[model samples]
Target: MSTSPDRVGVPASDGSDTVIDVAGLHMRYGPYEAVRGIDLHITRGEVFAFLGPNGAGKTTTAEILEGYRRRSGGQVTVLGEDPEHADASWRARIGVVLQETEPERDLTAEECLQLYAGYYPAPRDVHQTLALVGLAEQANVTATRLSGGQRRRLDVALALIGDPELLFLDEPTTGFDPSARRAAWDMVSGLRSLGVTVFLTTHYMDEAEYLADRVAVITQGRIVAEGPPGTLAGREHAPAEIAFTMPADTTVDDLPDPVRAAVAESTSGRVLVHAESTLHILGPLIRWAEGRHVDLPDLEVHRSSLEDVYLALTNPDAHTV
Candidate 1:
């Protein structure tokens, strides 16, 4: 979406229909460049994931979009206002969730939300927000007494009390256990029903795959890849792997010559074929295997997962241990 100078803080007539529009974004700290020439386009109500290893400029870029920090250079318009110059009304249209907020030990879950609700001019019903985050049962429970997962839900409740049009979820499930993480994923998934645009930053690849409509990966201050979770970094075009244990009484040489040619690996009585086209390579092999009356019980079909593609896109050496 292109920005119109006259409509910097409102809907535009420049044929632009995006919630966030960034072009040539850059952030500098002293002599070091953090975010460099990143371009992003996020439409309204879309769930977008920004992923990268540590110190890859994700935080800096998010802060810039949130209006907490000023960028050294770039054109950033979030919710129709340049975040750097955004006012209170613009901020009211967005919500941000950190790992956790300061403990509201003296307040109950409902009270905590009520206090935050007062901050917004047109707040959502406190009860509805509590129920939406699955915290209705804990409404009267003191914030400090809630379980870790429950506290996280309260964080989400606080963020939602304002009925924000855009939400920034920054590592919302950072330290959650497996069950807690899954529960959090479900809650985040429910946001789609609300029609609120979500900007999610997470370390879990599965979380991104399950939640994001599209994902962008950053490395060394640049966007290296961006696409749907299933096809990021050409994952959809990656070669398929056809794997199985070696058939008894059969050697690689004994297989049909066509199938043998597809064999990329054979070791420890196991064989793997990297098939550009699974059916063409697999048909000949399966026919040959069944002809010998053999079962390929351990056979598995595989593709490069999101995590695998992510690893291939970023440099491991650049991440801090």
Candidate 2:
């Protein structure tokens, strides 16, 4: 497949509902710089995924944005304030769910949320938040007794209890089964319609594809690509494949020149065409088959999946997080 990549994260804007505006973000541990010149603009009510391989500065950048760590140099603003210097009010407007956190083992789901709700000046209704994360049934279960997925939902409920405008979800569905994970996805998807911005980080490509409106990939401390999932790294522009089973009596020479020109292979009872222009190839092939009264019933067209594009960009050896 041909390779084409989108430009890095666009410059942060001022005249929009941009919830997170970052520019030239850099972080260093001694002389080793973990995060390079990173740039991002996450708008309000959008689910934006930050993806990268391990040791790619993903966590470092997130911490800097979350106010848990200091960047060596760069401009960062989340919720309209510099997190490094922002006050309590700034923190109150956002919520965060880390990859893993020890829950309050002694407290029931309802009690834990009730305890955290007191910390927020205007928390959402405790029961409503529980229902939102699919945890209403488990509200009376102790955190230690609840299933893994249930605890994760409780974490989400805790985060939402603050009525936060922005939520940072890091690997939110890590321990979930297929059904549980998809349920979490639905909950996160609903957050967008409620005008809550989400900054999501996940290793699962399908999760990112399903949940994010836009995504950015960071590797070796810099963004390599940024765009919508289908268009990111120009996955949408990759060559299309047109394939069909070769009729018993057919040969490549029997096909019209236009169709023949597009064929990548024709042997072993199958013909494959790499279509740079799908219509150009399809029309001629269909007409050729019609003229011969041949059935193209087995024909199919395929595009590169997001995983295919990502592997191309990161190389087969790179493991994502």
Candidate 3:
């Protein structure tokens, strides 16, 4: 097969064909409803990430999209066809790397890839697939003999053997070390360069931030927020946290007037200010410390991060009480 990928689907708003669309989707487990009327869209050649805590129905929703589960209600379309009714041809165009995959323990990685490749009409070269996932050296090793990171790479290689137009990755780099994780990121970047649509789920905010073009936060079986990684869940404008050690022999009462006023109004009692720029508060803090004849000690400033946004949205009930 040619290395150049065929164009898949597109987005709805831009007049391009949508790759995946879900409208008011719901899934039930007898008495309980897991997915509660959720809607989402994924465009062609884009990496869309889904973030949610355990039991928030993220996996349920993904399985429904993959045609593994029948929906209780609502509509779901993958590659412009209803996932529930799609045939084998539709399945051939999409590759899925699920969280828990157990190959025959005695089978070598190369053998496993070769076995799966036979099912596809136009699979990628086995050697190239193994190298793409950073498992080139471990091709001869049995699945039981490979390390956690190496095994994960094999899983990814199997997913790509079909040369799928769209790929689904569930926690793709969960067990990888730092270096291994970076390698996985590079591999995903290469996939994007080839114009393949990637849908992934990851708990590591940094991973999602690096890989996903757009991310959606699902909470209580609903999408609380959806946008680009930087702006999702209001992370772009969230307040920064500032902490500094008080000067030696200086009591809170001895602080400068302006500094004392600001500190007094702070509920945290540590001069926490919600400001756009840290410098804005730093200037006043430094001047006040000098006027009070006390030296500032160990100042630190940190802005809102994606982790903060995730915790805020996923655990709103914790904050509510």
The predicted structure with the larger lDDT, 1 or 2, is 1
Which has the greatest TM-score? 1
TM-score for each model: 0.91, 0.89, 0.82
lDDT by residue for model 2 over 1-321, one digit each (tens)? 111133232233344698999999989899999998999999878899988767788778878888999889989999778999977666767898988798997999999999887776667889888999888888888888988888888888888887888899988887689999988999999887778999998767798899999989877898888999989987777788889986769888788888898888887879999998888899988999889988988999988777766666656476521
Query: lDDT by residue for model 1 over 1-321, one digit each (tens)?
Result: 122233324222244469899999999999999998999999988999999887888878888999999999989999888998988767777988875576587999999998887777677889998898888899999999999899989999888877788899988888899999999999999999998899988767888999999999998899999999998988888888888888788888987776789899999889988888888887888898889999889989998788888887886553321
Model 1: residues with Cα > 4 Å off, grouped in runs = 1-16, 316-321
Cα lDDT computed for each candidate against the true fold: 0.85, 0.84, 0.79
Best by lDDT: 1
TM-score of 1: 0.91
Model 3 regions more than 4 Å off:
1-17, 175-179, 246-261, 264-272, 276-279, 283-297, 319-321
Question: What RMSD does each model have against the real structure?
Answer: 5.5, 8.9, 4.6
- Candidate 1 collision pairs: none
Q: Regarding TM-score, does 2 or 3 come out ahead? A: 2
lDDT of 3 by residue, 1-321 (tens): 333344332222344658889999988898888889999988898999988777788778888888899999998888878989987667777899898887667889998988887777667899999888888888888988888777777888898998887899988887789998998888888898777899888778888889999998887778888999988866767666676666667566765554455442333234554446556667888887778777656676777777778887888755520
